[model samples]
Target chain A: MTPTIPILRVRGHLLVSVQGELGDDVVEQFQNDVLSAIERDRGRDGGLLVDISGLEVVDTYVARVLADTAAMARLMGRHTVVCGMRPEVAATLVQMGYMLDGVETALDVDDGLDRLGLPR
Target chain B: MDPSLTEVLQFDEHQLRTRLAFFRIGEEELDRLAAMRPLMEEATAQIVSLFYEHLLSQPETRDFLDDPVLVDRLQAKQTAYFLQLFEGRVDLAYVENRFRVGAAHERLGVPPRWYIGAFDRYLGLVRERLIGRGVAGAELVADLAAVERIMHFDAALAIDAYVAGHLATHARNQAALRELASPVIRVHDRVLLLPLVGTIDSFRAQQVMESALLGVSEEQARVLILDIAGVAVVDTQVADHLLKTTAALRLLGAKTILTGISPQVARTIVELGVDLKTLHTRNKLSDGLELALSLVGREITDKERGS
Candidate 1:
């Protein structure tokens, strides 16, 4: 089983970069970790930034989990932003029929942070 | 049909053969074929040589037999083909062989017209030889009729092969064109540009939406400029497709600016009752770019002002 993606707190936002392959266990762990991190950092309620640039492939199931994670985070008062999807992965995910609806996205961690952390 | 391409095209060979029954090959033709075997064995080598001589001489068919080595190889195959053809050995294997002949020619860029023309040459020679052997008027006519039926069957099978090849090529081209149509040009760090051209259909509309949403997220674009200046027509579905793409991008925290909407397109959108209310529309890419720059907190100033 691959290790759980690391969740870091940078200036109040929860930052997670998904690298390599995520096993079934790893994705389940990721979901639990992000949810708990939001709960742990309650006072600030800073956004969540999930960067997937390290991934070469992302299947529909994984894409669904990412979207679900963002939606779950949003209900907890923390804005969840997904960022850094590779072009190949994006094309594949689109082909796989994942729209990633309502999940905030940005080019990288910096862009994602601004999109989520700052007001529009 | 090559089974793989046939599977994709849903081509039915059994049905095709049933349809080709109009050419009329039967037991009587098979009997005539058996009668011709001894003579065909003697004639096969010479006829194969003459057939290729005619093909290689023609500028059109010559290209199909360009390599001298390949021509030599084909002459041997054609010799064996004719010998078996007259021996009444057209079982399942022979039918399959006939299909392969057509497909092979189609792949090598040999037109069916040439194959039919080759039959004309073969028939003319066969008439001369049968007459030389003392097979007279009515029997010769019957023999010729049987031969004609078989050649027609061969020609029809070859046409099926050609059609299948073209269908496969057309499908491949469409897939390539879709990939080519959606190009995401990233102009700035936080800005992405999409210039949509040509007629938009529901299929391509879905393509555009998927492409734009994914591009916006992939590039982390804060602003997207969708320029539709070259698009000839827009209807309700197209308007809906564009709106869905914009909405998806907006939720991804990207602002979308629809630029290059011709006066005609804008009227079509409004008349069709697609709300362009939420979108920031622009007449030109320059205006769209300026707005995108401002959205990303940048500005372009004249050199004279600083000087």
Candidate 2:
């Protein structure tokens, strides 16, 4: 089995970097891992930042999973910012009718950090 | 009817017959015209010269008539056309020939009134000549009536071809305008501007969407400012098109700022309840530009007065 993606605690905020084309199982595992990380960091004041800059493509299923993760994080009292989506990927996602609604976006990791109230 | 000829002339035999019937020209009238053909054939030269004199008097035609060779050539052609009227056969060939001449005149930018007026002069001169030859009473009236009906019928066919030419030119211009309608401008390093003016029909809306996507991807634009102040109407359909554009732009990682909302348009949007939550709108283009600059991490500041 491929190992689940990593989630790191950076300056009291959870940071997740998703790269390349991840399989459905890997994305689901990452979703569970992110939720638990958000649960464990419930006392933290910062938001969750997801950096997808390394990802070249994102299918509708993966987009849905990310949006779900963001909503779950918000429910846990942590706002989530998904950043670094390439222009083509974003265009394909919107064209495919997967809007990724209810999720905040940033230009890159730095912008994501800035949105999360963490200056870098 | 020849399909190719009818297609080019946009007139079939049935249509021509209908026009002739409308002008009340029947076999009796055609027979009368054919009988007078010899008389008209003899008078063709005199009538054509008189017609040219009238043409030379007009400022628009004087330029073409200045060349003696050209005027002689035109007069020869005009004589043949005048004699053809009294030939008494308004067949497919006759209709096709008239259509071709009309289209040629349109290409040369000759106004309809000039050709119509030329026909009127020819008719008047023909009546005068027939009477001068001592044809009297019912016979004079019959010939004049037959000539008038055929001339008017010919005029109708020519005008049809003229209108067809105009419609083709209009369609060509519209296609060119559509191409220039949507232009995406890259104002800053990572900002693009698309100023939309006029109505947003489905065809133009599709163009706008394609331009926006291509512009955003090409420029790697972080923010796209769409100014619709020149857009006169803000209906539900226009709002829907704008929403789709913004939604697509969002996926491309570029934020869309809609500017140029007149107060009247703002009221219409509210009245329609267009659900503009997904879109970011500004009252003026300048405000949208300011916001777009900030989104791309750049701003204009006053220069230091004393360095």
Candidate 3:
């Protein structure tokens, strides 16, 4: 069974908090879920915020999944701001040469809301 | 250049023999030293007492020998050391023992000048005794030459150990300075300031990366301003390191603003054709801070202090 990632709505912005390492299938499911949530929240100017602070490790595969989700969200007329990325995970991603270049980043949920032009 | 700690510690029998040969202390000198052992043994206690007497007279040396119990113990050790010189068995064991003596003096914080002066005084006493004992001209000169050569050899070993200890301490201090050089200061909430100074080398660049990344994580910082006004040069290598750090910070949800680029460094960066499109740079640290503040969804608005 694929573990489901929590995707909550805060101020109309989708906040996805990833905890621990995810298997390949789980990450794929998360990507699909994030896109579906963005489609469900259509007509509302909400953005995506992924909180990977609790994730101890983020290999290249997980990083690509998040980046892909952000790219798909952009096509649906919504922005995605990745927030609460731990430093070690960032370092690992950078070392592995996987840069989520087009995705916006913020410090936390409040900053994420600010990025989406929402009241913090 | 001073020898490394490993070289000093590994002063083997071959090295000892080479040093003896360098000092021209051949079989003849060893024979002379053995021949004069009885006379030197008789004068050992007197020599040690006289040496300590001269040392105790000096204010600097007197401070180190303030305790009478330690003085007594050291005096006994000095007597044995003096007698060992005349016994003429200058082997690896003997050289190793001399190294211990030098290391002990170094640990005690005794300066080189005092010990050197003490050796001179000790040699003078021995010369005076040899004359007083009615030793003739040619034999006296030969014995004195041997004694001087041996003293020189012992001094070399001790000084080597002393210098090696100092070099080790210098290395430890340098390591501490490297750690201090890269300080990640949290100038504002969710914003960090790393003011880098000195020349950028690969080692220091690694230090900067580790410190900045760890600082961002611990502070949960959203923005970092790296002010490099004090950095001496901006070569391609340095630019590469800075870019790598900036890219890493971006992944951690932090925007890195490079600041404090001097006019010359700016020209060099342009001339060098280093690509810095992904990095945000400002002229001064304050400007960088402004950019950083804005990135974190905050701004520094001017208002009355009372308000």
Clashing pairs in 3: none
TM agreement with the true structure for every prediction? 0.65, 0.60, 0.60
Chain A fold similarity by TM-score, each prediction: 0.91, 0.90, 0.89
- What value does the lDDT take at residue B231 in candidate 1? 84
Model 3 per-residue lDDT tens digits across residues B112-140: 88779888998899889888989888998
Q: Which pairs of residues collide in candidate 1?
A: A106-B220, A107-B220
State residue A92's C-alpha deviation in candidate 3, in Å. 3.6
Model 1 ranges off by over 4 Å: A1-6, A16-33, A51-72, A84-102, A118-120, B1-35, B44-81, B87-111, B117-153, B168-186, B206-222, B247-255, B267-278
- In terms of TM-score, which candidate is strongest? 1
lDDT of 2 by residue, B14-132 (tens): 88788789998999899988998988888888888888898899888788568999889878888888888888788888988888778878988888988898888888898898889
Q: In model 2, what lDDT does residue B51 have? A: 85
Q: Which 10-residue window of candidate 2 chain B scores lowest in summed lDDT?
A: B1-10
